[model samples]
Target: MAERDDLSRGLWAVVRAMWSEIGPAGKAVLVALAMSAVVALVLGVAIPKQVERHLIDAEIRKLSRIVGAMADAGVIPTGPAQADELNALDEAVRLNLLGSDTVRVKVWLVDGTILYSDEPALVGAKYSLSEERIDAFNGINSVDIPNLSLRENEFERGFPPLRELYVPVADDSGSIEAVFEVYHLAEPIETTVGNIQQLVWASISVGIGSLAIFTASLILVYGRSIANRRRLAEKLFGELVRSQAEERTRIIGSLHDDIGQTLYRIHYGIEDLRSRVDADNPVAGELAHIGELVNEVDGSLRAELRSLQYGTGEELALGSALDELAEVTEMETNLSVSVHVETDCELSPPTRIALYRAAREAMTNVRKHSLATTVEVRVQRQGDQVRLQVLDDGVGIIDDEGLGLTTTRERLEAIGGGLKVKPDRRGGTQFSAWVPASECEVET
Candidate 1:
């Protein structure tokens, strides 16, 4: 259960880290871009067809009106509007609409005769609108079918394609009069629509390409930024460890050169004094007893001296050493401190120094300024690095005016360690340091 919980926590942490990198700005942009793309797809593909159909309808109605006017004025048909007049109107319609090579317009009688046609040879031909033959026809209409005949005023292309219109003319009686035909070059409209489609596709492709590149760029920038920060952090940890090791070595050397020699001299003098004393005279008896006591005192002193292991300069065992330093410091300064140090692995000298100095600096700050009664030093090792924390339940820092922190920071930095002041999770200023073991291991 514990392992599972740890794994779940780790996965969630990774997810949170990823979310932090992408952020809200990126998500909003992606959503807006997606909506825009949907709109573009609809507009680019759908609008042109609608426009073309509307244009064709309008042109067809106008054709019917023009032809109807001619018929009403006795310009076409027999009786009041005779066949000669009808022929004249037909010729006029032909001349006007079919004059252009690109346009083919024709008029057909209900009997399927090509009454008027733009193509001369096709005039008077039989008309058969098998393509658009319908159950019922609208007044003014346009459709697309297959091959169109100019003479019969009938046209064909395809469904919603090259459009042709057939408009029916009506007299005062509202009777079906004649059919008027209008021609439109749908290829141009289709071509224009095609061009628009190509442009839209191109634009969409470019937009998607750009979006992909931009997204990739953002991810890359964040990734590199995080990587650089991690590198800097690691380097700091290494330096702290190395600096701590160096400080420990220096302190050990100091102990050996100063206190060690003093203890050695004291031991030898005690030995000589004991040898000189005899058991004969009364004064000698008293001196002999004092000399024996002195020998016991010398042995105790020698035992105390052994604590340093003369010039051993061995890496300090993490937990015990921190407790010892705290104990000695409390005795000297009258400051009450609780040291909580634990470690699972052996520590290098540099890492130990970094942790110790960081704690010492915090203690010094407490002693000089905090005037607090309780101080805490905690050190723990996790995996490859050691983390140390120092906290004081003293008066909070007064506007951060102290050099101990700066000096401690410098010392830790010298060996690639990190020092930072954070609001103690428990309500105080906490100084924390971390150093890597690899950096702390000094050459013997």
Candidate 2:
């Protein structure tokens, strides 16, 4: 029973998968084939029976015509006939109808009296009639397989199966005068039915086979087209990512080379001028403050530049990069920041960069929007995914996310990762991000 259940489930899964992958046209074709197969099966079984019925009907009509002709020729007696007359009737029946196929014949009166039969013993005998035989008196013809077990059919006992046909004989006034009954060997009719069934089944099989091949070909063509389109889309996405990375690297290089050095020189010039002035001079005080401001700006710029270079440099480990982010956030804002690295697995460069960006974005939001006094950054590997969580003790949950965070989420999702932000249990907001570790693992 368990194995049967498993097999049913497996079949259901395959059907579901196919349903999801195929288009409307493919589904329609499958439905049509299913309906056609059902119809074909029904016809395959029913047509053979109809053919046998028609064959029996043809035999009854032939026998009825022969009997009617004999009556018209004055070969049948209306009342009880003499021994000579009976002999003449029997010979006529044997010559006209009795053969290998037509095994028996009986002429009967409306009162259930057998007038003449090829078997001499049944001549002028009376027997009780069944409804089917009585129906012949009303001009209704029928065919059936006779029951040889009955007393009336004792002579036909041990005989092969036979088809019994009944025909009503009419006089000159269109009145049924007598009933003619004929029995034919069933083997010939059965053989004919078998041959016809073979032909019908063969035709049906050919049609179904052709339809199946057409449907399969259509599905194959459709599947290949979908696969090709998917491959093209993936290629385009990869190229777009590479181009963006290159552009970002170029911008980082320009900032570090030109703006960073210029800022450094301005800070030193201010410091030198302040040192040369008198200590009591108000001008020296202002110059000292300006130098302090320039130094702060330079420090902030250098920190951001380092963060931008994390994945591009030789040191692409996320653990160290996250620690640096915590330090910078703590220095820039008076927030107490902590870092926890709970996993040792190396992440690929893209994963490292995505995680770093998520962390940085969360910290920036915390500093700008949250009136938080403390923050915690944690990284861990769970199953096949690496997760990053940044929690800040701040004003409860915020409903709207900034544009930077939205972009960060898209970037993470592009690499089979996702981002979430919710209210932390510690009375602050928690920013969480996860990426598939299997796909983002560094090669050994």
Q: Candidate 2 residues 208-236, lDDT tens each? A: 99999988899768855644553454355
Candidate 2: segments with Cα more than 4 A from true spot: 1-15, 237-444
Writing each residue's lDDT as its tens digit, candidate 1 over 79-153 gives: 233456656876767654544323655555556555555555666677665434221123434555435444333
Candidate 1 least-lDDT 10 residues: 131-140
Best by lDDT: 2
Q: Give the Cα error of residue 34 in candidate 1, in Å.
A: 3.9
Error of 1 at 184 (Å): 3.6
Q: Which structure among the candidates has the greatest TM-score?
A: 2
List CA RMSD, all candidates.
13.2, 10.1
Residue 102's C-alpha lDDT in candidate 1? 30
